[model samples]
Target: MKKGIIYAVLAYLTWGFLPLYWRLFTAMPAWEILAQRITWSFVFVAVLVTVSRQWRRLKSVGSNRRSAAAIVLCSIFISLNWFLFIWAVNNNHVIETSLGYYMNPLISVLFAVVFLRERLSPGQWLSLFLAGLGVLIMAVQYGHIPWVAISLAVSFALYGLAKKIAKLDVLLGLAGETIVALPVALGYLFYIQSQGTGTFTSLPPFSIILLLLSGAATAMPLFWFAKSMQLLPLSFVGFFQYIAPTTSLLLAIFLFNEPFSEGNLISFSLIWLALIIYSFVTFKKSKVKVVPISRADAL
Candidate 1:
């Protein structure tokens, strides 16, 4: 349990601090950065798969057309999520990015009800209502929809749904998706290079190193998160999930100096309230017991 807590904390801390890492590449276009991330992430995971001897499982995924299709869909969602997040960070929309993650769990609940045909408890219904109210309040205040938050939430929710249906092991599933994305990523990088506008051509050695390290940044926390989930209850892991967005929120307010108007506070407060209610109900029903962990737990 202690090890699980430590691992979970480190995983979320890494995710929280990721904005700092991506900010180092502010000079690069989000698309290029995303291409490099997908390409190098595959390279990194390929090595891990070899070392762990998980290639057989990865091969099995390719043999199953349904699984491959699910992974392809997952890749698209994750790539979209990654690009938007990198873009949001570079564009100084960190608060909006954080709001997206804050909305993610609630969005997942809604997805479950709608697509999975799962029945929601009373607490779940109220929680969803509160979250919707929060979004509405933010829209009213900003005079525009909080599209960044909504897009992030919905894309990630869809990614989670794909993973749930695919039912592959976490590492294997990631490898599959990254492999599926690798060709397009390479093609984009090649096209950009041909245009003579790619950052790779002009970047300093240090920046190049950082770009390569994007692979580690993308995969390592996920590895730690998977390890932690293996040791902890799903409910405990769910509780820890809030740490990432909370850290992002703090970073946005203090480190990044993003705008935090009164309306933002009121909106976030409602969402937090909803999360608190949701967590309480989940814990009460699960009785803090460990269950067979699912891919949704990792998300």
Candidate 2:
């Protein structure tokens, strides 16, 4: 249990601070960064799998049709989530990104109901109600829609659903998703360099180093998270889920100095209140649980 708590803390800390890492490559387009990320993530995880002799499992990722289709969808959505997050962080929307992560668990509950034929308890429905009101407030604040938060939440939630269906080992699943997208990523990076629009080759040495290390940044927390999930009860881990977004919320207001308006304050209050209620009800209900995914929340 202690070890699990430690792992969970480390994983959430890493994810919480990931915005700083992604922000380092401000010169590169989000698309290029994502491509590089996918490419190097594949390289990094591929090495780990080979060294751990998990290559056999990696090969089995999409053997059957359903799993194959699911893996493809996983690749697409995770890629979208990654790009959106990186873009949002760099573009000064980190607070909105935080809001999205804050909103994700609730969003996943809705996803479960609609797509998985799952039912929600009254407490769950009440949590959703407050959350929806919060989002409605945010939408009004934005004067249209809070697309960044919604997009990130929905994309990550969809990724979680697909992941639940995939049901592969976490590392294997990541490897498969990266591999599925590897060709396009590689081609795009190659083309960008060829067209003289590439940022990688011309980046400063330190920046180049960080770019290479982004793969490690991207995948290692996931391993830590998987370890924690294995060691801890789901309910315990679920409480720890907000650490990443809460960190992001802080970083946005203090470190990055993003504006946090009154509307943001009110909406976030409602969302946080809802989460508290949902979590309280959830924890009180049972020890055996099926929980929604958190930030960096893989199945």
Candidate 3:
């Protein structure tokens, strides 16, 4: 349990601090950065697969068309999520990005009800109500939809659902997704270079190195997260999931100096309150005491 807690904390901390890492590539367009992330992450994971002699697992994925289709869909969703997040961080919307992650668990619940046909408890319904109210408040306050937050939450939730249904293990599943995305990423990089708009050509060595490091940044936390989920209870893992967005919120306020309007605060407060209620209810009611399952348990 202690080891699980430690691993989960480390994973969340890495994710929380990722904005700072991506901020290093602020000179590049978000698309280019995203492309590099996908490409290099593919390369990195491919190397890991080779080193671990997990080639058979990759081969096995090719035997199932349904799983391949699900993974392709998951890849699209995750790619969108990654691009939006990087854009948000670079474009001074880190707080909004944080809001999306803060709202993700609620969004997952909604997805479960809608697509999975799972019934929600009364407490879960109330939590969703509070979360909806928070979004409405934020929309009213901003005089527009909080699309960044909404998009992030929805895309990631959908990605999680796809992964859940596909039932692929973490490393192999991610490898499949990245491989599916690899061609598009490479093609984009190629086109950009041909157009002379690519950042890679003119970037400083340190910046180039940082871009390469995006692969490690993408993979390591996921590995830790998968390990932690294996070691811990789902409810406990769910509770620790808040650490990432909480850290992002702090970084947004103090480091990036983003304006936290009064309205934003109120909306966030409502969401946090809802999460508290949901977590408490879930912990209290969950009595199965089953071991955590290993197939993409969380996003």
Candidate 3 lowest-lDDT run of ten: 232-241
Model 2 misplaced stretches (Cα beyond 4 Å) = 1-12, 224-241, 288-299
lDDT of 2 by residue, 63-87 (tens): 7787778889988998999999999
Model 2 clash pairs are none
Instruction: Give the per-residue Cα lDDT of candidate 3 at 155.
Output: 93
Model 2 — TM-score against the truth?
0.85
The Cα error of candidate 3 at residue 109, in Å, is 0.6
The models' CA-based lDDT, in order, is 0.80, 0.80, 0.80
Q: What lDDT score is found at residue 247 in candidate 1?
A: 87
**Residue 81 in candidate 3 has what lDDT?**
92
- All candidates: TM-score: 0.85, 0.85, 0.85
